[model samples]
Target: MDIVFTVLILLLAVSVSGIAIRLLPFSLPLPLVQIAIGAFLAWPALGLHVTFDPDIFMMLFIPPLLFADGWRIPKREFYMARRSILMLALGLVFMTVLAVGYFVHALVPAISLPVAFALAAVLSPTDAVALSGIVGKGKIPGRLMHILEGEALMNDASGLVALKFAIAAAMTGVFSLRDASISFVIIALGGLLVGAAVSWLFSFASTHLLNLNEEGDPAPGVVMTLLIPFAAYLIAERFELSGILAAVAAGMMMNYTSVANAGPASTRIRAGTTWSMIEFVFNGMVFILLGLQFPHILGRALLDAHETSDVQVGLLIGYIAAVAVALYAMRFVWVWLLRWFASRGATKHGVANAVPGLRTATVTTVAGVRGAVTLAGVLSLPEVLKNGAPLPGRDLAIFIASGVILVSLLVAVVTLPFLLHGWRKHKDPHAAEETLARTMAAQAAIRAIDDVHETESADLDESAAAYAADVTARVMDLYRRRLASLDDEQESRDLARRAESLEFTMKLAAMRAERKTLLALRNSRTINDETLNKLMREVDLSETALTARRK
Candidate 1:
């Protein structure tokens, strides 16, 4: 009963957070709002306390979110930014581990080198989700955002893997550079292969065994998709591989699978809606969970430090500030070097102004906000060593990690807006490709309609054929007008667009009327509830399609 009540409370909190953001006068990030709500709920008067379990939290929330990101992120952009992504995700992660790790130990002499490395490793993974939440959609430049997204997708695994080795070294008091390097390679590659293979196998089963291609209920296939991330994660872990990579790989693999491409339209629609909801709920819960944990972690640590000495409280805070600064500094330098090198190569190829800008570097550095993964990794550190004695600095490390996460978030919240002001006013880079796609699709649709019209009219009577021809012309005219809107001539395009706008208005009005009449019939008992619902669904779908096209 307690577990069920807690789950319900979390879900309710997620829903309420969404509403609260809209009610507020000023614009705030949704994650921030959710966190605030969580902290409020955790007030002593409210008496809401939830245990934070790192392993369960990772298993439950990480996979699906990562999978969704992989599935939705543009494959073309990901491929193009592969080099930069690898440089950030792999190179920068290791660099931060080494540089920031040493810096942490030097700053706080009580922390062991191994534990410091573990702290740095956890802090290495940036929370692109948090960044996205801070800067709403399309606020960042498309190319930069894609690179950031790709980096985030890949680094979670790399950072966690580093932490694993760091933890092992701390436990055994033995570390081997060569063996760890080899093991990392195997873990990463194996996870990727396993994930891709699992996605392929699911696709095969859905098509050949499940027969999802045929007209039938799509719920089973959609449910299976929900399970894919969990399956991939668990299977990869069972093999002692990188489950995070496995989940990411499975999501990326979804793009190339028959299940994604060849599935029925209904299946696609259902799956898209289901996944969207899942992502929202899971994301909200994760942030809320963080908020729930923060008060206790920070409060308890500060209280303990204050009991010892007021100066100790300041020292703890200084540790967090120093670590956060070190992370940002390391990230800035690494990014600057990467861009400087890229600029040199670009200049050799005659590209102008390829050098890195201070703003760009700073934005990238600030965007590296630590999130749930960092907290989870840090908290997962073992409490006891081989001799069963307490692990030194464990509490302090958790406090520092939590503090850094909050500080990074707060920093980004404060600075990112100023930096991103007027960024969205820039012309969309993909506008031309979008227009081209629309023009081609409209032309192809017309051709298909014409072909079907001819086949249907071949053996018909003259009157019937005339009616079919008229219907075909009416249908094809829609596409013809759409094509005209895409024309190079500004006057023709403007006229077509006005006509489209007028048509959209009329269609929307008509759908609303249909819905109104359906509801009236239901109220008057002139139609059964089932009949009204059937007709209402049709009207609703039409309105959705019409409104979507207008947008």
Candidate 2:
């Protein structure tokens, strides 16, 4: 009890420090900072000790973290990057396995091919959460960041799938390409079908049976969204299917079916808030847990490292370095190939949005830093081998993986800031300044118009005065919103720009409706031709005013 309390206090202090540092102007890698703090606590004099249970760790951490990532991923952006995302998520994992496995076997002959493959498969999964927590706080482009996030979300399931196969081959002394291929297909396909069906059914029920308005209470809707991924995953896994694929499919389905169908205001905001909290707690716990376990893992590995004969400590380090470098290089190659493929799609449309550019590709490639899932798979390996023998080089493998993680941590912490710094320096600085000025000008213009309307409204007839007051109120509201957004002038300008586009679209639709109504009125002789002509002129003038403003 005392130990638990002490650990909790330590976590609280570290978390507070992390938040405080972030609150400052300068940025640092939050995970690396937390890791350092935990490590410092674990130093002999501080004496922070806690029991480590892998099962407890997974049970407590994995589902919420995975679900939150799945939930928070923007549905639209994910779909936009879906083509490259799928290739990176599925095809890239296979490529990584073969590349890392081939290299490891060729470089380290003492380690059996299957074991090396296990290492490869385990290390292939990247931690998007970790990368985002570290690097994403900076000025990376939204499109590029989304692509990396998409890849991270999907590749997790892919890496796990590969790990399962590699572990099976290592344990059973069997490596059948045909069987593995068939199993992967079946599991992947089956999981997707199950997830899609379940997601569709749930969404349908929520929309139809529930007397839910888009602006109504969101707690129930939020809870339902939280449950879908895990339920989908477990149900599919029970049927001998891919739980990971099921989770992904369910997430995609929820985004496409439920979230997209939701109205823009309260429903979306509520769902976003719920997912945000889940993401925060889950991410905090995962990093803290990872840091806490490191000392114990290192101690155990050191004890067993001395007995390992298959690979020396030096060779293991070399292998880890080689794998890390190879994995990074492979990511660059794969991303380039995917960009080429995605570009073909974009060329068909001739738009920037449809195709990601070179900078986006580079950022995506570098963002793939391996984290928890990799360690999970490596540590999950059997401590004892076949025929009553202890697993050869198991400790060495863990140590190598740890070294790789350390390398990855260092690279992510150091390189991410540089990347962010460079991007911020190059990307749209002046545009923001210009936009801010325009938004302020627009707000001032609106305010002036409102003041004139209110003054004129005083002497008007009741109906005219009420109408003028209503218009004035609306104009004032818009100006107020614009003023509220004045802190970030460029961001406000972007909003105004988008709002202007939406306003144009709405006006166009309204003009068409008005034209139809006027034609009907003329045909019915309810309104005269002169009145129709005047209405047409007013609408045309309104259109011109909007067009001039846009210019």
lDDT of each: 0.93, 0.72
User: Candidate 2 on 1-551: residue-level lDDT in tens?
Assistant: 89678668655855665686668688667777666666655666766765556445544456557656665677877888887677888888899888888887787776667777878887777787788767654466776777777877777767777777877777778888888888888988898888777778778877776634455676776678778777777788789787666766776676667544664345665677677766665566566656766776665665455578536545555777887898888888888877777678777887665654666666666678777677777887787767777766666667667767768878877776665665544555446877678677877788689679968987999999988888888877766655644545688767765775787789888887988899899999999999999898777767666676555
lDDT, candidate 2, residue 489? 66
Candidate 1 at residue 386, lDDT? 87
Off by over 4 Å in 1: none
lDDT of 1 by residue, 1-551 (tens): 88999899999999999998899999999999988888888888987899999999989999999999999999999999999999999999999999999998888878899999999999999998989999889888888999999999999999999999999999998999999999999999999998888899999999999999887999999999999999999999999999999999999999999889888977998899999999899999989999999999999889998999999999899999999989988999999999899999999999998888888888889888889999999999999888999888788899999999999999999999898875546688789999999999998999999999989999999999999999999999999999999999999999999999999989988989989988998999999989988898788878878888889
Q: What TM-score does structure 1 among the candidates reach?
A: 0.98
